[model samples]
Target: MRILIAQINPVVGNLKENKRKILEGIHAARENGCSLAVFPELALTGYPPEDILLLPQFIDEVKKELKEIAGATQGIAAIVGLPRANAKPFGKPLLNSAAVLFEGKILGFQDKTLLPSYDVFDEMRYFDRAEERRVFLLFGKKIAITICEDIWQHAALSKDVSYPLDPVAEYANQNIDLLINLSASPFSQMKAERRIHVVQKAAKTLKVPALLCNQVGGQDSLIFDGYSVVCDAGGRLVRLGNGFQEDYMVWDSEVKADELVAAFDKTEETYKALILGLKDYFGKQGFKKAVIGLSGGIDSALVACIAVEALGKENVLGVSMPSRYSSEGSVKDAVDLAEALGIELRHVPIEEPFQSFLDILSPEFKGKEPDVTEENIQARVRGVILMALSNKLGHIVLSTGNKSELAMGYSTLYGDLCGGLSVINDLTKRQVYQISRWINRERDIIPVSSLEKAPSAELRPNQKDSDSLPDYEIIDTVLEAYVHDHQSPDLIAKNHGYPKELVCDLIRRIHRSEYKRRQSPPGLRVTDRAFSIGRRFPIVQGWV
Candidate 1:
């Protein structure tokens, strides 16, 4: 039997288009003489439909589309992920389900056994766990079908997941011929290896071939990398699908396949993930042009490069808003970067507006020394110029605040934080440099000066980032432990050999910046624990 894995990108809430994609995949699979075709979890309504799943009309529409999709499955069998209404009138009113369609009819659904409620996933809010596990016979082979988190019960591979039932393992003695998992797993650093390991373990446990069909494309802050997989019975990878985009592959049981080994470069993978995320964010929302405020700094430079790559240089516009504090080299770097990028460069000097603000606030600050308030005016003046361009030019402003600055409350809210989207808010200062250097590996794309220059906001004279915050090395280390790993300040300081007071102070800053983050634009999430939708913190909390 030949099984076609259809890794598709589905826009959430677009039932008609998603249905069309599924039908197209089924037709293609049938043309290839494949017996079975598989799609990713929640392929119909898209993964993590979120509050849309709460709408009865949306579920009803999905059912209508599923019926049509079932009727189209004449020459081939298909397993599609969708939301199934809970007829029992209990347990969340819906099931995260996979509908099995064969020969123009609807077969029984295999509901997702594990409803993940951590990090970016909140499926338990809208879905109920599967009551039982079952094996189905398709093309004379007994197969166990699982949904995203259902097959993630492997002990060593599970990331903080604790489930009572192992859905795939339940069919251990049932003589299953294949184990299939339909996934909408989001992309994070090193997630592909973990996924490969999971499928390998499942194939070995079942002693049968295993396949995974993952969803692709970006949905809000989440980017589903479609690196689908197929593993042979001995737990070796046979087929690997495309990464960071939609793909399709067929695995034939009769044809012997060899293991395909691959290595993932962290920097390259992250760059691709960000590119996809940016592309989809703009494309899905009907955004055609992007306007970035280039400060001759690393953050804005990186965002501009990514925007140019994702949306084309024609669609990307760079504006250099120079102030009194901005250095001549900084302004020159912006011009050189934009010229090299082949994008339209507009010089919008904020010096006039900045001086105006300082003059106006002179009376209010009569006796007060020039402090962060005066510095913030410069940032806010730049922000106003960017917003005005965005308003007049029909382009989205891309904010260029990195994660380290965002974490330590180093950014000025309503100033540098003003944008429709934050491109690198998830990447730390260290990662920003890493990716910037990687971009310049072959040639100088992201200006070597931008990479080597001291990090600064240029809000005032000689305002290096290190003057206010710790070194990028120390900050990134603490952020990885405190923010992502959820380690305590004392433990982080002890483990990383940092001063306890410094660590504690950094943690406090992160907590105090909750209000700023809350107001910041939604950024592309490349990390497991981004400051986006998943990591919830209270702005008024005193927990720190």
Candidate 2:
């Protein structure tokens, strides 16, 4: 039997466009003489429509689109996920469901059993869990189907991540030829390996072949990587789809899968995720150009490179807002970067505005010594300049702060934190350097001087990041342990070669910075624990 994996990028609430894409995939599968085509979870209304599920008109449109998609399944059978109204009167109004269409009609519906409730997910508020095990006959084989979280019930990524029920085990008890899951699982560093492992384990435990087809594209901060997979009965991967974009694949039961999926380095995956996230963010919003404040630092340099790559050099505007403390080398680096990338470089000095602000606030701070307040005024001047340029030219400002700075509360609010979207907010200082080196592996796209120089805000005289925080290596290591790895400061200090006092202080800063992060722009997610949606902390907590 030939089963086609239809990995489609669906925009939330675009009913007609989503239906057209679904039909396009099914027709392609039919032309290839495939028996069945599987689409991603929530293929109709798109993934995580949030509160739109509560609208009666939105639910009504979903039903209409479901019928329309079913009518197009004349020559092939297709599985497309949607929201189905619950029949019971006492539960949540909707079921996260999939419409099985074949022979020009809706054949059956499979509701999602396991609804994830943690991290970025709030499905418990919108969807009711399914109560039955569904085994359907498709292409002369008994196949058990599931939605995204149903299969993830086996993977222990979090505490009690699995549901009380087990869909894989239920199918394992019965005689079934194949297990299929439709998903809208998002992308993160090393997530592809995790997904492969879970699918292999489920297929092995159930003693049947398994296939997972995932959604692709970016929605806000969420990015769905379309690296779908097919594992044989022996628990080995046979077919794998492409990453970060839409793809179509066919799996034959009799034929063994090709070689194992190639390992993508962290930098490569991070690069692709950022590009896709930026592209969709711009395209979906009907904006073609982006304006970035390039400071000649690695963070800003990297964001400019990604902007040029995502929106093309002509669409990216690199504006250098130099302050009184700005070094000539730094400003020159920004100009050289723009020249190499073939993008327009506009020079805007914030010296006059900084002086004006200081003159106005001089009497209010007459007795106080010059401190971070004066430095912050300069930073905010640059922020105001960037915003003015964006306002006049209709370009979105791209912030350049990274995870380490964000974690340590080392950045100025309303200054460096100003942007429509943050390009590298999820990446740490060390991660930014790693990807920078990788970008220059073929040639020096990033200037060598920028990479070698000490990182600084350049707001005050000879200000370095090391003045407030530890080394990038130390900060990133301690941060991953506490923030991403979920270890306590004392425990991390004990297990790792770190000082307890330093660890405790850094953890305190992380907690204190929650207010700043809450106000920051949405960032692209590339790690398992991104600051945007994956990590949650109380801003006023003293538990640290």
Candidate 3:
């Protein structure tokens, strides 16, 4: 049987457009002489419709579109994900399901069995679990299909205990010829690797060829890397689709699986994901231009390069709001970097605004020394200037603060943190440098001075990041343990050989800055744990 994996990007609630894309893919499948075409989970309504699933009218519309799509599946069979109504009134009114279409008629649907509730997923709240498994015959072969989470029971998230009922496992010993899985799994660092392992294991367990098709595009903060994969029963890969973009591929059980899977590279994958995330966010949101506050630091420089790569140099505007404390080299570096990227650089001096704010607050700060308040005034001044530019020009601001700074409370709220999106907030300070160096490896995209110079906020005289916190080399190691690994301060310090006091203080700052992070713009999630929907921390909490 020839199967075409239609990896598509679907907009949420745009039923008409989604149907059009689905029909287009089906037509292409027929032209390619493929017997079947499969799309990602919730291909009709888009993945994780979130609260839209709660609306009864919305589900009805999706069903309406599904039937229409079913009618168009004439020459080639197509499987698509959509919201289906459950006749039983006891549970949730909807079931996350996929329908098989053949000869312009409905071949019925297979509801998702596993409803993931942990981390970013809340499927249990909206979708009812499947009662039993079913098989559909196509191309003279019996096929057992599973939804996204249905086949992820053995993933690392499951720890060691398997689900009470494995949907794919249930089909074992049934003599199934092929196993198909529909997925809309989001991008997390190394998540693609974990998915490949799951697909390989499932194929081996069932002793049949397996294929998985995932959605691609940026949905809010989540980015689905469409690396649709196919593997034979021997745990060998047959085909792997493109990453970070919508793509199409075919897999035939009769053909020999000789195509080599692409090698895994974390840095390369993350760079592409961030670009796609930013590009799709603007494209889907109807944004045409972007603005970035170029502080001339490595963080801002890296973010500028990424923005240029995503939106093009013409669409990106670099605003350099240098205050009195800003170094001459920093200002020059911002101009040079913008010139190198061939983007417009706006020089809006914030010195006057900084002085005005200090002059107004001098009376209120009668006895207080000129401390963080003065420094923050500079940052807020720069923020106001950049935002004003964005407001007038209709440009989305890309916040340049890295994950390390945000975690350490080293950034200003409504200041450097003010933007429509945070492109590098999920990346640590070290990661920012790593990608910067990687970009510069081809040529000098980022200024050499920015990399060699000590990292600074440039809000005060002789201000440096290391003056307040530990070195990024040390900070990232501790953060990886404390944040991603969920290890305690003591354990991180002991295991990673970090300074106990520094690690404890950093952890304390991370907890205290919860309110700040909660208000920050949506950031692209490159790591397993990002400061978005996936990582939920109470703003008011005690961690003594």
Instruction: Please provide, for model 2 over 63-127, each residue's C-alpha lDDT reduced to its tens digit, 9 standing for 90 to 100.
Output: 98888888888878999989989989978999998788898898888898988887778898988
**Model 3 Cα displacement at 480 (Å)?**
0.8
lDDT of 1 at 347: 93
The sequence of per-residue lDDT tens digits that candidate 3 reaches over residues 1-544 is: 9988999999888888889989989988888889999999999988879998888899888878888888988778999988888888799888998898998899888999988887778888888999978999988999998999888884535542356877877898799999999999999878888888889989999989888999999888889999998989887987999998788797778888785666878888899999999998899888979999888889889888888889999999998888888899999899999999999998888878778888898899999888888888888887888888889999988898889988888889989999999998999988888888989998897999999999888777898888888888888888788888898888888887867898888788888988899989999888878876678888876654
Worst 10 residues of 3 by lDDT: 154-163
Clashes of each: 0, 1, 0
Residue pairs whose backbone atoms clash in candidate 3: none
Models sorted by lDDT, best on top: 1, 2, 3
TM per candidate:
0.99, 0.98, 0.98
Which candidate achieves the best lDDT against the true structure?
1
Against the correct fold, how does model 1 do in TM-score?
A: 0.99
For model 1, where is the 10-residue window of minimal lDDT? 152-161
Q: lDDT of all the models against the reference?
A: 0.90, 0.88, 0.87
- Which residue pairs of candidate 1 clash? none
